[model samples]
Structure formats: structure tokens, C-alpha cells
Target: MSEIKDIAKFHIFSSAYFASAVNKNQYVTDGRKEIAFIGRSNVGKSSLINSLCGRRKLAYVSREPGKTRTINYYAIQSRRTVDEVEQRQDWYLVDLPGYGFAKTSQENKDNWSAFIDEYMRKSPGLTMIGLLVDLRHPGLPIDKKAYDWLKTVAPDLLIIGTKGDKLSRNELHKNLAQLKKLFPTNHAPIAYSSLT
Candidate 1:
């Protein structure tokens, strides 16, 4: 696959906080394709999003895990040239609540789980799901469960391995190989780091 080196060259404009939804009823349904980002707490989901949008603080970076409790929606508008014609595309980048390692009550975790499950199962505009995992330690039990769930519910699922900067080049490659072996799907995890 070909990669676009300069994101700005594509004339893409991204709004960090277009909307937020705490429940299924509040999800934006204006017919825009939605890409949801999900992962364990403190796996750098928010940081990865900010980096992707080419912004320093587009998504809130909290020191503590589970700081994001709602489904945050970011609108990205892009203008592309195809066949000598200019075309515009708008989509929503969704940040789902992270799971695990939150110093919250069991009740709150259960509620978040329900909310995430509902959104994943019922959202009509959800086109893709990015499942983030830490490269230092990938394929934990929770990550495996999340991958299995997405495989059943969503057709387009991408595994993202975050915190690549923390590992050496050799370690990164080894861990990536391990991750690929564990997931064992056509969708291989992409190595990513906010620092890079």
C-alpha cells in the first residue's frame, strides 16, 4: 500500500472536539463514516489520535488511565484530487472509553462496558475500528477479548501497537512479530509512537 507522507498536502482539516456521546442515543448520526479508536487504559489512544491529526493537544492527554469516559467525536474534513477533479470527504474519528486499570468503582466500569458494547454493536456509521495495544506488552487477555469481540462485530478492524519509541529497534521487531503471531489475522498491527 502507498502512504501519503505529507498530511497537510491533502488539504485535510480536523476538528478535535466536534461532539461527545456518553450513550448510544447521543452518538452523531449525520451519515459521516466513523472510525472508532479503542484500547486498554493508558495505551496512548488519545495521544495517538492527537499525533494522527497533526496537533499537539487535539485529544486530552491525561496522566491517569480511564480519563476519557465518553465517546469523543472528532470531525476530519479532507479535499482530494482524483482524475483531475477535486473531491471533499468528511468523517468522524471516534475515541471510545478505554478499558482496564482505572481506579473506578466496579459500577462505573460496568457502565462503560455496556456503553462501548452498545456503540460497537449498533452504530450504523461505524466503518472501521482501530484496536490499540502497547508494543511493550501486546496480546494481554483483555486485548485478546477485545480483538475477538471486534472480529465478530466489525468487518474492518486494525490492530495498532503503540509506544514504539520506548523499545529498541530489535525489540520493536520482535514484539511486532509476537503480536502478529498472537492475533494471527490478515490485519497486522501497525507500530506507532507519539514521540516519533
Candidate 2:
């Protein structure tokens, strides 16, 4: 237990808060840095964020596609410096709902589109957008649409691939190659496993 505690001491701490709407006038007032996690529905964006934070239940995870219907804001505070107290840190994690769920109504889809557009365009503290993809099928049309749109709008972004444990070595190689061909210059797709 002591070893576990020692290990956790070095990590960045994160706590999430759910928000149904993006009303700048009445949201959190923390001036911390922010990063966004976004992808198509059922692409394991929640799972990926959970894995990165080393917390199984921190971010909501659901088997049903598009379960996250709202923009969840997380206040991520780094480990306190050498002699600091329990409070005061700088950073945040922003988890936007996954887009492109097929079964949803057109109205819902339109709402999500507009919400994402507004969030990406209007947020000032947002630093980077972590664009997630499923490793089994890296470059779908919807993924391309997101990539292109973010490129034109939020250029500071990172592309990551999830659900890699399902793929064999050869398939992973091939899929990565295809992704490289599809997105040659800007970003490289990283294989990630949330289950691990």
C-alpha cells in the first residue's frame, strides 16, 4: 500500500464535473489549462480518458453508443510542488460527448454538431484537442470530417487510436500504415488499450 501511495504521488490528479450545457457566464472559474477529448460515438473516448487518468470510474464509461450526451468538464490538477499544500494547481481535462452516433435523431446530431463547433471556436483556455480513433479502423469518413474540420478550426490537436488490444500484430501494422497514408504530415495515430 505504501508503494502504491508513493507511485500515485507523482501523477497528475483529475476530478470531473458534468455539465449539460456550455454557458460561459455561469461555469467554472478556474483559470487552469484545458485539453479536450473528442471522437465519433462508441470509439472509446471515455475509456481512453479513464485509462490515461489511471482511474477506472473517473470518467463515465458505457457500452451503449453515444451515452455521453453532455460536455463533461474535469479539473485536472498536477501534483503539488515540493512543499505545497493539498490545494492549488494548474490544469484541466475537458471531455466532450462523442459525435456521429448513427441511431440518434437528426435533431440530436445537429445539436451535437453545433455544440462541438461552438465549443471549439469559443473556448479561450482550451489548449489542445485529443482526437481519438479506433485502431481497428483508423480513417473512417467521419474521422476525416473531424480531422478536416478541426484542422480548419482548432489546429492545435493530437490524434490518438484506441481499442488496440483487439488487433493482431499484422493487422495493427496494416491499419497504422493506412492511417499514415491517410494523414501523412500532421499527426500520427497511437495504439492504445483502455482495458490494460
Candidate 3:
């Protein structure tokens, strides 16, 4: 973790909006590593991405849910050490469409679900998945289903607990504990708050 932070701090990190893919054929596959972000509707997925990149409004934020209907890609450039040699690397940050309780048409929801499933199963460059969940409401049935799917298809998923700022310290800890219980042997949930 320290090494990664050092690399990020030392390198010039710049990201630009790449392409938005509505289908598998339209996805960018230029041989760059990809990290995907996914979550339920209005779970602050965009805000989390913006915060990670240290750029305000890099990912579009909306007051309404289900605004992102496609798989949005952002190209990233940075420098890192490889085998004791420093080199530049290009990667992508993929923002996948949200699931659960979206006030969209059933057809649209089904389309998004199929697209997300296909992308998860077929994207060769995919390296990691960031699964965001609101801390205040930790265990929705949709979240459980998503977790189970990822467990089978993409076991290298990182659970991110969003909206931590909305909870008190005790509540945050308790919710995090519950989250850990859901994925007991997996990596611990990352508590994230856009405010701090």
C-alpha cells in the first residue's frame, strides 16, 4: 500500500473520459488494465470515483438515480516501477451501471443487468472490481445477489462502504462488522466518505 501511494504521488496522474459502451463489442480493449466500480442506484459510485482520482466532477453526479445507463470508461496514465525499472503505464477506470431500485423501465433494467453481467464475464483487461454499498443500508437483497455473483465470477472484489459520514462512529463500526460477516474471508470493507 505504501509503495502504491508513493507511485501515485510521484507520478503524474491524469485521466480523461474515454468511451461509453452500451454493449460488449463497444468496450475499449487497448491492452490496458481496468478497475471497475459498481453499486446500487444512488449509492455514490460516481462520487467515489471522483474522490479516488482527486478530481471534482470527473464522473458525472446526479441527484437522480440510474443516470448512468452505460459502461463509462476513463483512461488513466501514470508511472510505476516494474522489476526495479520505472516505466509509464496506461489503465482504465470503468464505471459500470448501477443496480437495485432504479426507477427506470423494466426493459432498461434488464438491459443494464445483461450488459453488466456480460462485461464482468468477458472483459479480459479487468483487474479488480470495487463494489460500493451504502453503510446506512448495508444488506439489501440486491446487494447480496450482486455479492454472490461477484464471488463466483470476480472473487477479487473489494467491498467499499460508502456514505460512512452519515453514520456515527459506533454505527459505522457496527455496519462494517456486518459487512465483514458477509464476506468474512475476503478483504475488509473500505470505509469511504466523500466529505473527508
Cα RMSD of all models vs. native, in order, equals 3.1, 5.9, 3.1
Candidate 1 segments whose C-alpha is farther than 4 A from its true place: 1-11
Clash counts per candidate, in order, are: 0, 0, 0
lDDT values, one for every candidate: 0.83, 0.73, 0.83
On the 0 to 100 scale, the lDDT of residue 132 in model 3 is 91
Expressed as tens digits, the lDDT of each residue in 110-180 for candidate 3 is 87888888998899888778889999989888898888888877636788999999999999999999999
Q: Candidate 3 local accuracy as lDDT? A: 0.83
Give the poorly placed runs of model 3, Cα more than 4 Å off.
Answer: 1-12, 80-87
Residues 1-196 of candidate 1 have per-residue lDDT tens digits of 1112222246666565899998778989899888889999999999988887889888999998889999999998877787999877777889999998658999999899889889988898887788898999886999998888878886477778999899999999999998888876556678999888
Tens-place lDDT per residue, model 2, 58-94, is 8878889999877787665566455565544556677
Of candidates 2 and 1, the better by TM-score: 1
Candidate whose TM-score is highest = 1
